[model samples]
Target: MRLVLLSLLLVLAGCQAPASNQASQPKVPTFYNHWELFAIDAVKVPRLKPAQRLDVDRNYMVSGMAGCNRVFGQGKFEAGVLTFENLSTTMKICPAELDRYEQSITEVLSNDPKVTMYRGDLVLRANHRVLQYRLVKETSSQ
Candidate 1:
């Protein structure tokens, strides 16, 4: 009788679920997916002539176009935290105002930002800014 009870208790323990928080943690989206900037700080993003966008790959590489310049760097996403490193951009000159916007984007990307999804939009929050991006559907050519 004692052996049976011990075995039952061990099986019960093994069957128990994990902690609530652990079970409830949001699943990280596939970071390798492509996305396009949609808005910043709740403001509609200005249309860029060259189309600013971001693309991340499984190899920890990030590439994007920032208004007027091509940008690429190393980036990592873990546990909902996104971080960029060693980002470099082309020196091409854009409009003064657009250049400022580009700088802001680079600054945010280089920081340790918290990433979340809202209403099918990928939102990145850092400091006092919130950037929202929409998933970019893959083209058949790619």
Candidate 2:
């Protein structure tokens, strides 16, 4: 009886071992895709009527909306760091609040920002500002 009980316990222990080992590997976050800015500097930004979004492809080309203007540029992401260059926006007037918001976003994008992932959201920190974006899912027109 004792031998059987010991063998049973060992088998159960072996089964649980793999479960713990599988969870030991942590998930690494990747940002080579599209995301939407949901908050700036910790303040929630309401979704725009026509939708504002940011796209960063595998080639690191940056294109998106900044307030009421269209923004396009080149970006680099390596070693967990991100930076944008030559960012240009369309010459369009916007509401005072949106213009201010655009300034804050462009300011960060123009400089190098520390990037991290929190609760599945991509976060960028720079110039005493924090930009939090949520991943945008791709939809097919079909």
Candidate 3:
């Protein structure tokens, strides 16, 4: 009886793959909270009002911005590399600093994803765990 029970347990365990063995999202190199500023780009700066579900689509990982209209830009996330083409924001009137904050958001869209002051860097997972993006803007001088 002991031998039969041991064999059955072993078979059950084998049938169920180990947690570590389960296929999971790809891992990135590392994460950083803040990124250095660089020249802003004219072409890539996304429109003021982003009317899209930025996070749902595996297309990109994004978050930030308040209401739909008069939206204040927050942050964005991307896997591998980031792009300014995709941004979701509400259109809400904001103060000067918030407006400028939105501009900065556009600038960093290429440098690195919006970072948490305390969190440092955001973790980009295929699912809910927000993704990271790297923005590369083209200077207007060109």
| Every model's TM-score | 0.75, 0.72, 0.31
lDDT of 1 by residue, 20-135 (tens): 65789778766566778888888888777677788877765878887688888987778888876677888898898678668767767767778888887778788778878888
Please tell me which predicted candidate would have the highest TM-score against the true structure.
Answer: 1
Candidate 1 residue pairs that clash: none
lDDT of 3 at 81: 49
Residue-pair clashes per prediction, in order, are: 0, 0, 16
Q: How well is each residue in 30-74 modelled by candidate 2, as lDDT tens digits?
A: 676678998998898898754567877666788888788888888
Angstrom error at residue 35, model 3: 20
What local distance difference test score does each model get? 0.77, 0.80, 0.39
Among all windows of 10 consecutive residues in model 2, the one with the lowest summed lDDT is 133-142
TM-score of 3: 0.31
Residues 1-142, model 3: lDDT tens digits: 9999999999988877664466564654333222222212322223334321122223234444422322222333445544445454556676664465454443444344433222432323221223333322222332
